[model samples]
Target: MERNAIILAAGKSDKFAPFTYEKPKGLFCVKGDVLIERQIEQLQEAGVMDIYVVVGYMKEKFFYLEQKYGVKLLVNNQFGKKGNLYSLYVARNYLKNTYICCADHYFPANPYLNDNPENLSYRACTYLSGKFREFAIDYSDAKVITGFNVGGRDGMAMVGHAYMNEGFSSVFRQFLENEINDFGVSDLFWEEFYAGHQRSLTFYMKEYQAGEIYEFENIDDLREFDSEFLMNVDSDIITNICNTLGCVPNDITDINAINAGLTNVSFSFQCGGEKYVYRHPGGTSGNLIDRTTELFAQEKAGKLGIDESVINMDLSGWKISHYIHNARNCNLEESDEQLETIMDYLHRIHSVDVASEKNVKVFDNVAEANKLMEMASMIKGNLKREFAVLIEKIDILYDAVRADAKRLGYGLVLCHNDVYEPNFIYDSEGKVYLVDWEYAGMNYAANDVGSIICRYDFADCQIERYFRAYIGHELTDDERRFYYAYIPISAYYFFCWGLYKGSIGENDGFFFLSSYRNMIRFIDVALESYGIVI
Candidate 1:
């Protein structure tokens, strides 16, 4: 059989942050040497030099290894969504007589040889005192692998390294190719597959002495093995995580990356036996959001008991908040009861007595978007003419709403300018709280109301329900006209905001068009029914 090796480096290593934020865990430098390079050098010393590395998280960074160390690179495009089982599946063809390796594993010396006593393949493990809840191995007296457990008292803990002969690889590959297509089991570890098929396979347990192998489950492990990473890991996220929770890096575990956030990069971790979220700003957030005002709004909301998930938020725009398990966003269009709950929170937010220079003037934003579109060189041709016409229509509606605000004594209150489904976190106990105060400022309370109406795409008939549910009573004709006019103006501002985001190279054309088309219909309604034309 031909000697070969497959190294799995495609995992994002959420626990390895904030180093993995810049590069994958395999690229981390330990003792002045790249982690993956050391593993490759050790494999070469064992005469298994034909190494194939499957990379996904930071695949480009591993490209230079092809020329430097004569290793072949295989790409796993689903690395972010899938686990190491998929990484190994990507290299399924090269499993014969192969030493399966992990990129983050640190071996003190070469563990392979050119010749062995027999053709038997093995699963390597290290004995532990039974404290950590890691995968444990169970074997018979002849050392044939029999079964596995999640945690065992003083038993061998399963390590990543393993070997497979021609026969072993042929049988395992058949199982892999069959089960991988099932999306339900796509996230399973390769050992899980082995656990399922242990009865049909023959394998031996190769136990290693203590201090011979290193998995570096956390930063403290890597720092202990190689003293370079000392008192602090070089990660601002970790620094902030430690500072906010008053705990060391090791105290933070179960770190899973929450990649679904719209304008932030976040990870959820458990510290001091409680789950919390750490959000680092992303996209155009640094330039678009005023962190100072956001800090103040959050503090104000905290005191008002509207939202208290905020643990700490720094000037650098990184934030830590307690995670609400099984929480869902507030979608009023779906549930009228949810609408009442969210509006109560909105009403409380609008009633706050605070002073801030931050102000939201919708027409002013439309004017600014006009300037940004021309400056980014995006305005051109028929699109420019259409935008000009839209602005003209918005001007009339803007004047109409301004007249209503002045004559009716409608004053500005603290408002959450950005109100969408995802911005509200509702827990299982029927408790809901608003999030993302970056856009909150002194604005008309209807600005918040219009946000709910505009985002949910409420129909003409449904406006009355939202209006009555918000004001807690049947509306007067003047109040009805005042609120109806602001919804289209809100839609126009959203359209302009989308245009501005697109000019900066965000994929927001759908947003711009949806709001623009919606605004055009409502703008005409306001002009005929609500506009004073003064």
Candidate 2:
């Protein structure tokens, strides 16, 4: 008795668009091997001698399988018009004690389909499942499938592979024949016969632990399960990561997603009882961030006992850092004590030597706004006109601040140019730390203070209190004027930066518009307070 296998690859698989238009879903590859090809290789490894593939859309593409892998092809012309049961019905004559599966599904290990080639039929099920929108399985004490439904809350989900003996295959084929000929149910699914006609058929169950089975229903589904699937399509990144860690890929126990920023992706994984965080900078981050500058700033901050420790970095800006356990973002509204602690860290950071070559000047927004102006000039629409008007208002604010800065002569310090509430982290021991120093550079101390105050929407008294805490003395009339002057300047900085990001398509349109609105609002407040009219 020869071990036989059947692969169902007839459906159009329209859910996976444009790519499916070129070839059938089975030809899609995971890791390196094509989906159906991997299945065929595994079947062959399990001693399957006779292999059959039901091909429909792009049937000619599968013809090479006959020569390459000794696969027999059964073409279903109505594959585009009917469901999978119709495809199975076309191959009813070949139904016997054989292993059956879909071509698009992948199994991590050989399922050993020929293990028990006796006349017993069984379906493979997985205990680890999430958000399964299709079918679910329910099994009884004898390991027999008792019930199946769509919205099943249990863990058992089909792995899209089953072993069927002659008795089960004959009954299934007869039911499919009746549906197609007597009931004219051309769109019926083969699983529906097992699920609906449960009283007549008993499918013995074989359960696999999670992560063993992966079914790529569509491109989106494929991406969600493995976001890094395409990054290391040939598994090169995993190999590189293994080399870097001096461990096998399997030794790294878990990889969990970390929601950090809009442009980049981060994940936390554990290996050898130690956890680490890995961040892959997104493509657009290169447009908005200078990784060299960031690396330098973070190193300097780490030396000053401020930032997280960088364990390792790859050439492609993939960073592996020591994970900070039990840490949460600081809430400024927590108390005055927390505010004082954060202020102390900021002052120390300002006291450190700045390695960044960039500077924040009062007239910096003028140059930034000009960049926006130059970009807006090329557009041939009303958008250009609106941006032109915004530039006019920006010019007035820039001139006002430049004149004040020249008169007051504010001092410069190493500043975290992008200060926000979320950047401050508080650990379990009440130690406050700062993260994300991409925009750190030598800038006016007032710019950091004003940026923080404005971002937190601080009241005038709160602003004065914060300044007093940092300065450790009363602000003279000139110093007060200098501090107030940077409020609108910092707002314009964010506004111009946001516009710059939008011009280069670095972020979404809503973020760009919000930045413009903030710039205008701060300009108005500064003009009204400083008695400068634009």
Most accurate candidate by TM-score: 1
TM-scores, each model vs. reference: 0.62, 0.58
The residue-by-residue lDDT of candidate 2 on 1-534, one tens digit each, is 665888999876756543453467788766767889999999999888688899988889899999999989999888866778777888888889888889988888887754764557988887644566656888899889988876455478777688888888888777776667645377767787567678877798887777777877665577677564445344444555566778765565456667536456676778788888777776456644556656666776777777755666654566777778898888766567777776777778777654444533222435544554455445423443666655565566667666776776744566676666677877778777777766665666777776666554555677788778667789986667666656666665565555555555455333344445455556666665567665
- Which runs in model 1 stand beyond 4 Å of their true positions? 113-119, 183-185, 220-262, 266-278, 282-415, 419-435, 438-445, 452-478, 484-534
Give one digit per residue, the lDDT tens place, for model 1 in 429-492.
8778888887666777877777666655557678778888888888887787788777777777
Name the best candidate (by lDDT).
Answer: 1
Task: Evaluate model 2: give its lDDT.
Answer: 0.69
Q: lDDT values of the candidates? A: 0.77, 0.69
lDDT, model 2, position 392:
63
- Candidate 2 total steric clashes: 0
Q: How does candidate 1 score on lDDT?
A: 0.77
